[model samples]
Target: MSGRLQMALSSNMAGESRNLGNGHNTNAASPLKIFGHAKSKIRQVFKNIDEYVTESDRFLSGVPAEERIVDAMQIENVKAYRGKIRGIIDVLNRDHMKVAFFGRTSNGKSTVINAMLRDKILPSGIGHTTICFVCVEGTDEPEGYLLQEGSDDRKQIGDVQKLGSALSSTKASEDSMIRINWPKDKCNLLKDDVILVDSPGIDVHPNTDVWIDKFCMDADVFVLVSNAESTLMQTEKNFFHKVSERLSKPNIFILNNRWDASASEPEYAEQVKRQHLERDIDFLANELKVCSKTEAEDRVFFVSAKEALISRSPHTSTPTSVLAEGYQARLFEFADFERKFEECISKSAVKTKFEQHTVRGKSISSELMAVLDNVFERAIHMKAEKYSTRKEHADKLDYVDRQLDMMTKDIKSKIYEMTEEVERTVSSALNEEIRRLSLLVDEFDRPFLPDRVNMDNYKKGLHAYVEKSLGRNLQSRCSKALTITVEEESRQMTEKMVALLPEEQKQNTLNFLPRRDFEIAYKLDCRNLCADFHEDLEFRFSYGITALVNRFMGPKQASMILGRGFVQNIPRSMPMTPQTPTNEAHRTMGSDDNEVLLALLATFSSLYSRTTVGALAVTGLVAKAAGWRILALSGAIYGLLYLYERLLWTNKAKERKFKHQYVKYASSKLKLIVDLTGANCSHQVQQELSTTFTQLCQQVDLSKADLQEEIKKLNKEIGKLEEIGAQSKSLRNKASYIDSELNSFILTYLKQKD
Candidate 1:
């Protein structure tokens, strides 16, 4: 056989060779026949090799393979070429990988990255410095700018000056998101194959959490930086737990910074470091320790980012000297960084294999596939059953909605009634208070002045007395003018009270109390009659009668004296009456005077009795109105509760729909995988099938994994829906119970009144 054919056949012997040694020797055959047989076998081998090479070349057409090495020496290189080709094919078809750096505020995360890159591009401080995610990749130009959301336009930042000013400015709004790009020339550390992302610092500020959550979800590798002083704090632990659960890819690297500071006492620091590493391994399973590049002693480089930037500029080389002194330390750090980087890259390759197994074919072994299929079928059956449960929940929610609708209407009606009742009560109370005030004033005047005088004259005398008293007091106190102007001040206090009601209540009584003339009046009447008699032994007795009439009426004035301290004292002066002398003969003729005295007392008693009764009636009406106000407030609360219930129901419905879609998509994907892998066929053709079948099987496994994931998601959604459904039912039942109790109380109150 030719050399090429021999090599191809020998290389494929393990995978494709078949034995034909039984009674197949042909040494006795003719020389021409032997040559012909060998030629035919060689042709067959060449055809196979040509086909395999063509297929491989087609698959890896655009993939870069310069970095890939098939063998260490020339002897095994030919034999290993096919295997190398297969590996390349697998890698070329795999998904792109990503890594993220995240941690608590002031953890020196940025500094560690600077140490890795041997330069600083990210901001670091005790307070919040990083505000948004910064994606860094190898580039040729040193450029940085901000990318606003919903726009393709980028705002160019000329230098660190703009970036620093933007970060430090008080006017920086929420819309400010920045992307910094620096060239390898500016910072040699940035030249690397891996993409590095510096996410907004987590747990530093409330606003940054949102950005971290979104960025971390898509991360393939998460490098968590924890400070030596507070390694694995509650927030850090919680964050790691969440990340592990959400992003199941196993590429996680934990770096403990500020180890030097923590290691002040060598033994203690070493113990603390070991303890931290053990704790992290327990929690995360992958962790590392590194001294913070920003603060290190004894061959430790304290990177001054400002100095590094200055060195890069053409104006001066001052920063160059500072960096040169620490070059040896930086070199050591870079060596360590290179080792870590290589380790991470190797782990990424393994992860790629895992991903390929998941997506390219059915990764589950035959026994595992059978078990999983059984489990999946059972899950499908469970989901079918859940349809009924979901329907039941939906029906319950619909019933609740209907009940809420009825409740809302009932509450609205009660509110209207309560509002009207409150208005009536307030009006009655105000009128009663006004009437009480008027009667008190009338009683006061009756005792002080029995005869009616011109109102103008009376007011003039009252004003003169008040002015003289006020003038004296003011003169004693200060040198200010005593301006006493007693103009009648009338207020529609009932109208003001009504205005305080809710807008809905105000609208309900629009007709009764129009906006332009919204006032209610209370009427009060006062009549005074006085009689005086005097008896003397020497003269006939004489009696004189004086009568005064006044009327006071206006809107309720309770508010006018609401906060004022008055009506605590009653005047004691008696009314003035004309006097007459009495004699022995006059004593016998005193019947007329006696009759006058009796009439005057009867009038006063009647007036007082009527006024007291009116005040009591008004008080009772106001109390009833207050009861209505309470009912209205309760109705408003019920309305708000109903709205909340509806929102919850809507969210539950959305979750159900999402779960259904996820299930359907997963099922179809699994079916396609099973068909491609030919997992349910006879075993006769299995041997003839190439690794293509295995690869396809791995793909099927990925689809099944996706299906399992969907199922898990569905289960989670179902649990949430169940929780909300139960909560809603409980709330509704409680509300109904409360309504029943309130109704019972109202019934009792009304019956008592009856």
Candidate 2:
């Protein structure tokens, strides 16, 4: 076992010491101590950023799926950044200044580390002892312990013997690491957050790249332990070259150990020392390009680890006065290497380790801020669009309401006018039908015989015929006006309503509208109303004057004028002799008959021209009842004359008078109910048109209600987005503040002051 590197007695007394590590005080203005403080501050910054990322992730997750501006993949990417930040935080928490040693076998790499530690912490011999990487760091515990890679169990080391035994018994790979945590009381370098890594000889390992990547990637300084008797070897130089390739401008120190062996070759010692020094300087400044020549000169040192260990050990009995040649100079050179290494490792560690983390923190904050800004802008745009859409819906609703009101007023006025027009049309048509009643009655071709049954049936047929003719004329004329007006108004209303409805609902609403193809009926009960009419079938003597005189002289004075109660019960099958009457009445009746005949002829000239007026000559009963020749001949002659005269008078006077009175009665009744029928027709039109328009109004109301509901929902969403935007903005400001603080701290501590 080797001892520690000895310090000058006066150098030790220059500063007050504490119990932290190797009696080093916290007040010491050391580079490594400043690096520790920088690491802690940078770690805190990373933690702050990590917290912000977590809050951002929660904010993104809480947003509704449709409203979320950031997609799921983007949120996942943010979460990945959080994971990376957390990994960085873990790294920063355990961060320390590290120095790794690389050299060939039996070059005293372990002895050099042991010398610096002021104790035999690592096994060193002529044979290969370190099979793998061994990292030694300081612990607060009084006793030291060993922790292997991938193992949670701790192997306690009370002394060097136990440490060596525990390291030998472990079956580990070349790339694996065994961590040896020693007490801070034993070593000042370890106490000040320095981790010294010892590796297998570079000669024994071909995997230089992997070795460097795993152990030397974060190493702040590298020490090349070489034989002072020999020049720098190819293997030692190649390892450092690869390290320089991996790490940008790595801090490297050259320690030429066992320089005391040079005492045997004193004559060539000065030349060899100069050769080693120049080559080492060339390797660092020229070949590796890691440092300048002036800087490399201070890095190169020749020392004997054995002598320095002996001088610094408290267990050794040998004194410095009896030591080998140039022992004091070697010890002083070893001490110089330590002092320079302290400064180099501290500065390199601060720049290499904490600077990169600070940059990443700033980048994360900037990216998240940009993402938040995009989200805020998107929310604002969405709110603006919603407002615009709501205004459009509200405007449309107002337009529909105004159009509906105007349509309702116009349609009502049109319906009232149409009702009046229909009533007038029906009245005019009825009056024209009554005036042509004789012609209309003549058109009834049903048999009218002298029997009571035939006369009664004939009266019924005539009543139906006249009633149907007048009703058909009125309906044909008036229905056109009602149908056209109602249909046109309904179509206009339907079109207006369809425009107000949504496109998807328009087809359904059209199907829901009522069809206006119903038939209009006018109830004119002609048969029941004309039941009192009597057909005058009695034989009359006078063919013209006497019959007209009896027709004008009705039972009552008012009956003739009013055309009511004019006809009395006459014998259906009996013939009556002509009654001789006053000449004055005959003259009066003749004057009236002449006027009536003229009017009937003017109205029904074409109707009579189209008819064949047949006359009965004789009856079989009159001829057969008297079998004697003269009697039969006389009776037949009288019957034929009476029948002929009666037929002529019936056609020209009795029938015409009967038709005139019936026409007057029917016309009066139909006229009395014309207003009612017109009213009914108008009401039907109004009801159909009003119902369709009302349903359309209902559809418009429903559409407006739906639009209002959507507007309300949009308003709520906008409010929520506004709140979220405010929160995101606040979080962005906090992130920016933390990022700025981290940059400031990095600039303050990472600068090289010593």
Among the numbered candidates, top lDDT falls to 2
lDDT of 1 by residue, 614-640 (tens): 545644555577876775676577667
Model 2 Cα lDDT, one tens digit per residue, 208-253: 9999888888888899999987889998988888888888888899
lDDT of 1 at 38: 27
Weakest ten-residue segment in model 2 by summed lDDT: 16-25
List the global CA lDDT of all models: 0.40, 0.73
Question: What is the Cα-based TM-score of model 1?
Answer: 0.30
Off by over 4 Å in 1: 1-97, 140-149, 154-167, 170-177, 184-192, 206-213, 262-268, 286-334, 353-754
What TM-score does each of the candidates earn? 0.30, 0.50
RMSD (CA, Å), each prediction: 42.5, 23.2
- Give the Cα-based TM-score of candidate 2 against the true structure: 0.50
Model 1 scores worst on lDDT over the 10 consecutive residues at 481-490
The CA lDDT at 611 in model 1 is: 75
